[model samples]
Structure formats: C-alpha cells, structure tokens
Target: MREQLQELLEQRVLQCVSMPRNQLHECPGIELKKQSCAKRSAEIVKAKANGRIKRKFENQENESVLYEVHFQYLIKQRGLFYMEEEVEKRQVEFYKGILVSDEKLNEIDGPREDVEDIPVFSGHEEGQERKGFRYDRMKAVQYAERWWNDFNPAYKKFEVDCTNYISQCLHAGGGPMRGYPNRSNGWWMQNNNWSFSWTVANAMRWYLPGSKFGLRGRAVDSAEQLKLGDVICYDFQGDGRFDHTTIVTGHDGNGMPLVNAHTYNSRMRYWAYEDSTAYTPNIKYKFITITDDSDA
Candidate 1:
C-alpha cells in the first residue's frame, strides 16, 4: 500500500505540471499560477500525507516543469502497531536543457552607468544652493527600528514590501528626493505613485550609485564592512535579477550584519539566510555604503 501511494504521489505531481495552461482553472489545488513571476507554491491533499511541488516559468512558449518536491509519509514502526512519519524534500534545477552550476547561478548583474547624468553639487550659502542631499545613517537606522512592523501612512504598501521599506529608511536618514514628478529617475514618493528606484529592488541597485546628487552610495568589498543602516540586496537565483533587500540594524556575535526586513516581517535577523526557500547556493549580494551625509 505504501509503495502504491508513493507511485500515486509522483503521478499527481506529473499531472499537476502536465495539465494544459487553459485547464489550470479547473485545478484549484494548485496554489500559484502566475507565469511571469518566479515563485513556486504547493500543498498536501491527503490524510496524514502531505506533498508540495514547486516550479518556475521561463517564458510563454516554455512549459513549467517541477523543480522541487517535498513529501511526508507514514511508515510502520518496528514491532509496533503504530506508524511513524518520515519527511523528504528534493530540489532540481535546469537551464538551457542542462543542469545549472553553482558558479553560474551566483553571477550577479554588474553596475551600469546608463542612468541620467548626476546633477553637480554646488557648495553655496543661502543665495546659492546644492542640487543633491546627503544621507544620515543614524536617522535611517532609527527609522528602520521604529517601523520594523508598523506601516507608514505616507507611502503606498506593496505585496512585496522589501524595497519600499528600504526606501523609507533611506529617506528618513535624509536622502533627498529628486525628479519628483518623473518616474524614470529620482527617489520621490507622492500619493500612490513613486519612482521605480524607490520601490523596486533591482532599480534601487542601479539608481543609488548612478545618482550624483541626493541618495548616493558606493559599492563595498564585503558585508562585514557595512555599518548600521547600510543596505544589502539579494539575488536569490543569481540570474542577474535582484529580488530582495534588507537594512542593517545590528550585528551577530561574529560581527555579521543583523538585518530587518518586511514581506516576511523579520526584525534584526541574521543576514545570511541559508534556511530560506528562496536561498540558493549561487546567491549574490550587493553591499552599499551611503557616502555623503553633509546635507544631513
């Protein structure tokens, strides 16, 4: 019976992935359906037996394939009338019809210089003015701690709030907003609208260093070099696409950055997330240091 059940479980997973895209609506047990989003969802549908399957969609022409599987099964105990449950999980990834390599998966997107020219900062008193503002690390860290869980009424909340939360922390630390009405550049937020850099993880990565004024940061060599209030970006799959961001709030005993983040509502957690499902061996990171705080 156990063998038969195991075979059936495998069959169900196959069926779930093989079902026609149009027929997806008929299968309510499937938790996630977005073709463009790089997320996988699954669940168990039997008594004392649980199963989960995850898959990624590349493009409209490609079929989604099972990438991961998790299952819990009941096993008979030695000389006992009761049964014991055993859990198992498996991960598989393929790229271009070949297995992916850790080195290839860890490759991150390099810095770009295609952003709008940085406005020159003119050092002038009252009558004269500078175009960019400085960043306050202390104020940013304070703001992060203050609103680790609470939502700020001024900004629009997103289903994925990591980048939005980081932007607020940067703004609180005195990062000035530029290009107010324009969404192509700057870090300003008005009503439900905001600059792409202000709310998107990948965009912020490019905007910070590219901007000569307002919010500016330089890339650092290591995570340990980061001070309190520094920012870190994560590329979970290392496909040059950054999907998450976090703020440094504290440090561990070994001096690792302890971070605070939204979306999962974590506070002062360890920076290296080896336990996360999104975590990959090829994970890439970007450490940013806000350089100029003269205005702050």
Candidate 2:
C-alpha cells in the first residue's frame, strides 16, 4: 500500500507534467495552470510531487484503507521573458488504496453553523489604543515559511486554522495584540483565550479594514499590489461572507504574490485559488496590505 501511494503520487506528477487536457480533467489545478500559462504565453517546463503519508487507517472487513497523503507539488514555468516556480502543499485522502475523492476536508471555513453568530465588535466606533509598532515584513515571511507545514507549540491549533495561523504570522512580524478577554473584540490570542479576529476568517476579514488602530489593514485594488506580509481574504461562495485568509510569503516571476496558508497548509501557492475545491466562478477576493498607520 505504501509503495502504491508513492506510485500514485509519481503518476499524478507525471500527468500534470505532460498529460493531455482531456486526460487531466480530474486535476483542476493543473488545468488552471495550463490556462494561466496559455494566457501568459508560458509553458510548464518541470513538475514533481513529493508525497508523505501522514496517517493511514486499514479496515479488514472490506479490504479497504484510508491514507492521508501530504502532497507537495513543485512546478516550473517559462515564458518568453520570465521564468517562475511554485510549490503547493495540500493533504489528500485515499480510500481503498486509491483516491476515491480528492475533496479536501479542511477547505471551507464558514462560521460553525451549530453555534449562534458571534457577537460583532465595531472597530470603527470603538477604536483600539495602539502603541508605536512597525511591521517586519521579512520576519513575518520568515515565520510563515518556518511554520507553513507545522504548528507552533506556543499557540493553540484550531480545526479550521487558516486565520489563526495568519494571525500568528502577523504577531511574529511585530504586530501588537489587543482586545484580550473579549473574543468579539480586538485581535488577540493570550492565556488560552482569543479574539474572533484571531481565529475566525470572516472576523479577521472584517476586522482589518475596519480597524482604526493597531495592526490595521488598507485594502488594495488587486493581489499584485500586496507586498510580503500582506494578506488576501477569500469569499469562495461570494455570498458576502469572507471565509479563508492567506499571508503573502513570496512572489512569482510575474510579481504576483505567492501565499502561505493553513487549513490546506500550503506554501508558495498561487494567490488565486482557482483550483481549490471551494472555489466558485463568483469568488471574491480582498487584497489587504497590513498597515501601521498610527499608534494613536
């Protein structure tokens, strides 16, 4: 089974590298890559996938097994005047020794429907008192790359941890924490308690732009305008509920940001999640450049 898992990873990489579009209909990522490359007059020159089995469960009752494969795909493309490379890390599940469905378990991040909507904090009305703090973009990117595939012991890990991880990156970059003891208030995670903005994607998405002080954000026009340590929020359903978030860690040859994120746990991934299972044609994105406007 282990050997077959490795073989499957290899075959998937090969398919992405050279398979026809009709044959690769199941691989949306690769198909989207091909479309992107065509638009830019680029061609994929190299591709590979390294797989590590994170967990496996076997059931003798029906000769079936489930394997959680951590897949890291490296792809290189060459255009007329530019060359670029990216790595996408995502966990895949296999059933009965092969993939029964490629749907990711940790993808969507809408508010937990079982619970009532969280209390909202009006950042604009109740402006937070912030001290002078400068954002360290390089340090944030360093922290992002350091822990993209792993969790830090110092922080609590959540099931849908995309925003939690991004908040950590911001903190690592010298972003100050505030609004403690109130989960609905300012961004913070301390003493085992946290703010909604620190863990909830939608909360952070709203908190940043509305925040008047302390680790605020300025919305930009597009992903290209964002610098390292900036953020991109996702509304996969375009229902006005922003769901997932990612921090910029690197940029491609074209200057578009390459992002690092949790939940799916990726690094140097393309900013637009065109291939994500949660993606819809109506997907909306919010490009926010993390700001340190004032300490007042």
- Per lDDT, the best of the predicted structures is 2
For model 2, how does the per-residue alpha-carbon lDDT over 169-251 read when each residue is reduced to its tens digit? 99999888888777888889999988888988778888888877778888989989999999999988788777889999877
lDDT of each: 0.60, 0.74
Candidate 1 per-residue C-alpha lDDT over 228-250 given as tens digits, one digit per residue, 9 for 90 to 100: 88889887878776778889987
Measured on C-alpha atoms, candidate 1 has an lDDT of 0.60
Off by over 4 Å in 2: 61-64, 70-74, 77-106, 109-116, 122-129, 293-296
Q: Which is the leading candidate under TM-score?
A: 2
Stretches of candidate 1 exceeding 4 Å from the true structure: 1-130, 293-296
